[model samples]
Target: MFDKIRDVILEYVELPKESITPDTRFLADMHMNSLDIMTMIGQLEDEYDITIETEDLNNIYTMQQLVDYIEERL
Candidate 1:
Protein backbone atom coordinates (compact mmCIF):
# COMPACT_ATOMS: atom_id res chain seq x y z
CA MET A 1 0.00 0.00 0.00
CA PHE A 2 2.85 2.33 0.84
CA ASP A 3 4.49 1.60 -2.48
CA LYS A 4 1.21 2.22 -4.33
CA ILE A 5 0.67 5.47 -2.48
CA ARG A 6 4.23 6.51 -3.30
CA ASP A 7 3.61 5.77 -6.94
CA VAL A 8 0.47 7.91 -6.98
CA ILE A 9 2.38 10.75 -5.36
CA LEU A 10 5.23 10.34 -7.86
CA GLU A 11 2.88 11.15 -10.71
CA TYR A 12 2.42 14.63 -9.22
CA VAL A 13 5.85 15.40 -7.74
CA GLU A 14 9.35 15.28 -9.14
CA LEU A 15 11.18 14.09 -6.06
CA PRO A 16 13.23 10.91 -6.01
CA LYS A 17 11.28 7.84 -4.92
CA GLU A 18 13.65 7.14 -2.04
CA SER A 19 13.07 10.52 -0.43
CA ILE A 20 9.33 9.97 0.01
CA THR A 21 9.16 8.21 3.35
CA PRO A 22 6.34 7.62 5.80
CA ASP A 23 7.37 10.73 7.72
CA THR A 24 7.55 13.01 4.70
CA ARG A 25 5.15 15.92 5.08
CA PHE A 26 3.00 16.81 2.09
CA LEU A 27 3.21 20.52 2.86
CA ALA A 28 6.43 21.05 4.76
CA ASP A 29 8.62 18.42 3.10
CA MET A 30 7.18 18.05 -0.37
CA HIS A 31 6.00 21.64 -0.61
CA MET A 32 2.61 20.60 -1.96
CA ASN A 33 0.07 23.38 -2.06
CA SER A 34 -3.74 23.08 -2.00
CA LEU A 35 -4.06 22.39 -5.70
CA ASP A 36 -1.30 19.83 -5.68
CA ILE A 37 -2.80 18.08 -2.70
CA MET A 38 -6.30 18.03 -4.21
CA THR A 39 -5.01 16.75 -7.51
CA MET A 40 -3.12 13.98 -5.81
CA ILE A 41 -6.15 13.12 -3.75
CA GLY A 42 -8.21 12.75 -6.88
CA GLN A 43 -5.68 10.33 -8.30
CA LEU A 44 -5.59 8.39 -5.09
CA GLU A 45 -9.37 8.18 -4.95
CA ASP A 46 -9.47 6.81 -8.44
CA GLU A 47 -6.63 4.39 -7.80
CA TYR A 48 -8.03 3.09 -4.53
CA ASP A 49 -11.72 3.36 -5.37
CA ILE A 50 -12.30 5.28 -2.17
CA THR A 51 -13.72 8.68 -1.39
CA ILE A 52 -11.62 10.83 0.89
CA GLU A 53 -13.56 13.51 2.67
CA THR A 54 -12.16 17.02 2.79
CA GLU A 55 -12.63 17.17 6.53
CA ASP A 56 -10.50 14.07 6.94
CA LEU A 57 -7.63 15.90 5.28
CA ASN A 58 -7.20 18.28 8.17
CA ASN A 59 -5.51 15.62 10.31
CA ILE A 60 -3.38 14.15 7.58
CA TYR A 61 0.03 15.71 6.97
CA THR A 62 2.48 12.85 6.52
CA MET A 63 2.70 9.97 4.10
CA GLN A 64 1.88 7.45 6.82
CA GLN A 65 -1.24 9.32 7.82
CA LEU A 66 -2.56 9.19 4.29
CA VAL A 67 -1.65 5.53 4.01
CA ASP A 68 -3.39 4.76 7.25
CA TYR A 69 -6.52 6.61 6.18
CA ILE A 70 -6.74 4.70 2.93
CA GLU A 71 -6.08 1.41 4.67
CA GLU A 72 -8.85 2.02 7.15
CA ARG A 73 -11.32 2.81 4.39
CA LEU A 74 -10.39 -0.35 2.54
Candidate 2:
Protein backbone atom coordinates (compact mmCIF):
# COMPACT_ATOMS: atom_id res chain seq x y z
CA MET A 1 0.00 0.00 0.00
CA PHE A 2 2.83 2.32 0.85
CA ASP A 3 4.50 1.64 -2.47
CA LYS A 4 1.25 2.26 -4.33
CA ILE A 5 0.67 5.55 -2.50
CA ARG A 6 4.23 6.62 -3.26
CA ASP A 7 3.72 5.83 -6.92
CA VAL A 8 0.49 7.83 -7.01
CA ILE A 9 2.20 10.83 -5.47
CA LEU A 10 5.07 10.52 -7.91
CA GLU A 11 2.64 10.65 -10.80
CA TYR A 12 2.05 14.30 -9.89
CA VAL A 13 5.32 15.42 -8.31
CA GLU A 14 8.91 14.80 -9.24
CA LEU A 15 10.00 14.00 -5.76
CA PRO A 16 13.38 12.38 -5.22
CA LYS A 17 13.26 8.75 -4.20
CA GLU A 18 15.22 9.45 -1.03
CA SER A 19 12.85 12.21 -0.05
CA ILE A 20 9.76 10.01 -0.04
CA THR A 21 10.51 8.10 3.12
CA PRO A 22 7.59 7.35 5.44
CA ASP A 23 8.29 10.29 7.73
CA THR A 24 8.78 12.88 4.98
CA ARG A 25 6.47 15.85 5.45
CA PHE A 26 4.31 16.39 2.40
CA LEU A 27 4.29 20.18 2.67
CA ALA A 28 7.46 20.99 4.54
CA ASP A 29 9.89 18.44 3.20
CA MET A 30 8.38 18.02 -0.23
CA HIS A 31 7.62 21.73 -0.64
CA MET A 32 4.06 20.93 -1.65
CA ASN A 33 1.36 23.56 -1.41
CA SER A 34 -2.40 23.23 -1.24
CA LEU A 35 -2.75 22.76 -4.97
CA ASP A 36 -0.15 20.06 -5.05
CA ILE A 37 -2.05 18.26 -2.33
CA MET A 38 -5.31 18.48 -4.24
CA THR A 39 -3.66 17.11 -7.33
CA MET A 40 -2.19 14.32 -5.28
CA ILE A 41 -5.64 13.59 -3.87
CA GLY A 42 -7.06 13.29 -7.33
CA GLN A 43 -4.38 10.83 -8.33
CA LEU A 44 -4.90 8.84 -5.16
CA GLU A 45 -8.66 8.73 -5.65
CA ASP A 46 -8.21 7.46 -9.16
CA GLU A 47 -5.59 4.90 -8.18
CA TYR A 48 -7.40 3.63 -5.10
CA ASP A 49 -10.89 4.11 -6.55
CA ILE A 50 -11.96 6.00 -3.47
CA THR A 51 -13.21 9.53 -3.02
CA ILE A 52 -11.43 11.46 -0.29
CA GLU A 53 -13.08 14.12 1.81
CA THR A 54 -11.57 17.60 2.05
CA GLU A 55 -11.46 17.34 5.83
CA ASP A 56 -9.61 14.07 5.58
CA LEU A 57 -7.11 15.62 3.20
CA ASN A 58 -6.35 18.27 5.76
CA ASN A 59 -5.19 15.66 8.24
CA ILE A 60 -2.59 13.95 6.06
CA TYR A 61 0.80 15.64 5.65
CA THR A 62 3.34 12.88 5.80
CA MET A 63 3.91 9.76 3.75
CA GLN A 64 3.01 7.63 6.74
CA GLN A 65 -0.19 9.55 7.39
CA LEU A 66 -1.32 9.19 3.81
CA VAL A 67 -0.45 5.48 3.83
CA ASP A 68 -2.38 4.97 7.06
CA TYR A 69 -5.42 6.81 5.73
CA ILE A 70 -5.44 4.81 2.52
CA GLU A 71 -4.88 1.57 4.38
CA GLU A 72 -7.87 2.25 6.62
CA ARG A 73 -10.05 2.85 3.59
CA LEU A 74 -8.71 -0.19 1.76
Best by lDDT: 1
**Per-residue lDDT for 1-74 in model 2, tens only?**
88877777776678776668999888888777788789878888888898889998778878998888888887
Clash pairs of candidate 1? none
What does candidate 1's lDDT look like per residue over 1-74, in tens digits?
99998988888889999999999999999988898899889989998899999989999999999999999999
Model 1: how far is 42 from its true place, Å?
1.0
Candidate 2 pairs with clashing backbones: none
Query: Top TM-score: which candidate number?
Result: 1
Candidate 1 residue 68 C-alpha distance from true site, Å: 0.3
Candidate 2 overall lDDT versus native: 0.82
| RMSD in Å for all candidates | 0.8, 1.4
Residue 37 of model 2 has an lDDT of 86
